[model samples]
Target: MISLLFGAGASFGAELHKPVPPLGNYLFDKLVELGGAFAELPDDIKQEFRLHGFEKGMLSIPNDSRVINPLQKEIAKYLSSFKPSNENAYVRLFRSLREYAKHVNVITLNYDLLIEHAMLMSGAQKVSYGIDANEKSYSVLKVHGSANFVPVLAPNIIFEGNVSIGCGAFIETNQIRSLNSHEEIIKWCDSRQNSDLSPIMCMYNKEKRVVINPKYLESKRKDYTGVISNTRTLIIVGVKYIEHDNHIWDVILDSAPELIIVDPYPSEEFLLLLKQRNITHTLIRDSFYKSVLKLSLHIRSRVKIDPQI
Candidate 1:
């Protein structure tokens, strides 16, 4: 069982037109410029940003309707703004995942559906997006709620985290075509989201009150924790190992899977932590595609073609 933990940077190379809005405090300037709820922060929230910085400052502010409502809409819009071309590395990455890893589990902090699209495109026929019946299929645990995941008022449905959504505005994701282009996906997403007509999508918070499948979230955490504990090797791509993710760090450190970190600029704090902990790790100081190219020979020898085709 192998696990690939992804962050926002994981899909950076695959995005179309523009780059994704940065996670943590890097978006403070952008959010400020974008204005509206993000720009005109309340006095207390603004003070937190001034004092601590974006990451910690966000944590300080309450995740109430005032902040979360506006923020979710904006975030969803921002995440869905990009398109991945055929040449996108994610296509190759997911194909590799399908062929190489016997049991693949993805834990991601991104709200985009790039992984899902890639999995679908890579001929991974039965892919599970943390919902419905995904038995024996590739499991994608979206640590953060996805742009496609929408709030619903339906009863008897289990959801990941909890949020007080507008009772009237609820929607669900569908089985989109595997070869759907970025344009098709964007159109599909916009239709599903329904803009201001519907208030769906979940944002990341310790205790989020939004729409997502509880079954999906529960399985992801459990599987990731177990996989990290047992697997000899773990590949962490495009992640910064930030403070909000201290809990994940606890497990990764405790379990201590042989770490392969792929980032253009690796985190010094994380590297220091690895040293102090004496964790044997490899740092690939390159973009995701180059890193994959670096390991292509090893991968080629290990992976077998999918017989499903």
Candidate 2:
């Protein structure tokens, strides 16, 4: 089986227009561009983001800060606006994988829905998350949650204590199962008066903590392991192998599949890590846009040589 993993770089390459979503380092800038709540953030907070990365910087702040809610919501709103061109790299890659539909599994750490859009454009029947599927569907697992995965706040159910203990908000996985339309996402984001919902953005720390329900996260992890374990060829596009994401790295190292990493400039640290692990991998020193085209051609050539493959 073949598995595909994508990161922020993949989304950046798939942008249909200018101001391609900034990477983690430039996140604060993007948030600033959005103005409103983000604009009100103190200079120290912005400096912290610049000094440390997004995850570490976010972790420095208290979890219950008022800014957290608006931060998550604005991020979702900004990312939702990103649309991939009809014939983008993701579409080309999906088209190449069409022949091996059942044997393929896709996992993305990005919050954008570009993958879904591209899959549809590539003639995929449906996009399934985790274990849920139809025979024609392709599994598109989002390990770092998604722009559409909104947390639903539970009603006030406080226990009688010295300090009012109340039930916290949680994500309804069932709600995600039923979110089959763009209208549903619009409703969630556009509900200005309703503070009951908030977007579940990407990872901000090593603990993998989020305000949403834990079951949903567990489901994603289980599905990720199942895919990686069986992956013969793991095609990674635009992902940075950072220390904070060791959980993801642990699975890849344990599986130790043949790796194909696509990026313009592969990091030396990443190359060294792969070497230290004694895992065989190919580095495609090109942008995802160009690399995916090459990948598609390679796939086509292989099929022509042996149709049975």
Best by lDDT: 2
Candidate 2 weakest ten by summed lDDT? 158-167
Report the C-alpha lDDT of model 2 over 1-309, residue by residue, as the tens digit.
667789888877764454466788887777787676667778887777779877777766555424555567677767766666755788878877676666556889887778887877778788877634333676688987887776544445221111211323333434443244455666765675335345665446656666554567667777788888887778888898876676688889888998889888777987898899999898888878778767665445433333433
User: Candidate 1, TM-score vs. the true structure?
Assistant: 0.70
Top-scoring candidate (TM-score) = 2
Report lDDT (Cα) of residue 305, candidate 2. Answer: 38
Query: What TM-score fits each model?
Result: 0.70, 0.84
CA lDDT of every candidate:
0.59, 0.69
lDDT of 1 by residue, 1-309 (tens): 446788867777444453654655565666666675677777777777667766556666563443555566555555655555555567667665555535445677677767776666666666665423232356576655566554433445443233444432233333211213444434543452333322343334443434333444444566556656776667788887765555467789988877878898888999998999999888888877566654443344333454341
Least well predicted 10-residue stretch by lDDT in candidate 1: 168-177
Candidate 2 ranges with C-alpha deviation above 4 Å: 15-19, 131-135, 151-186, 192-194, 297-309
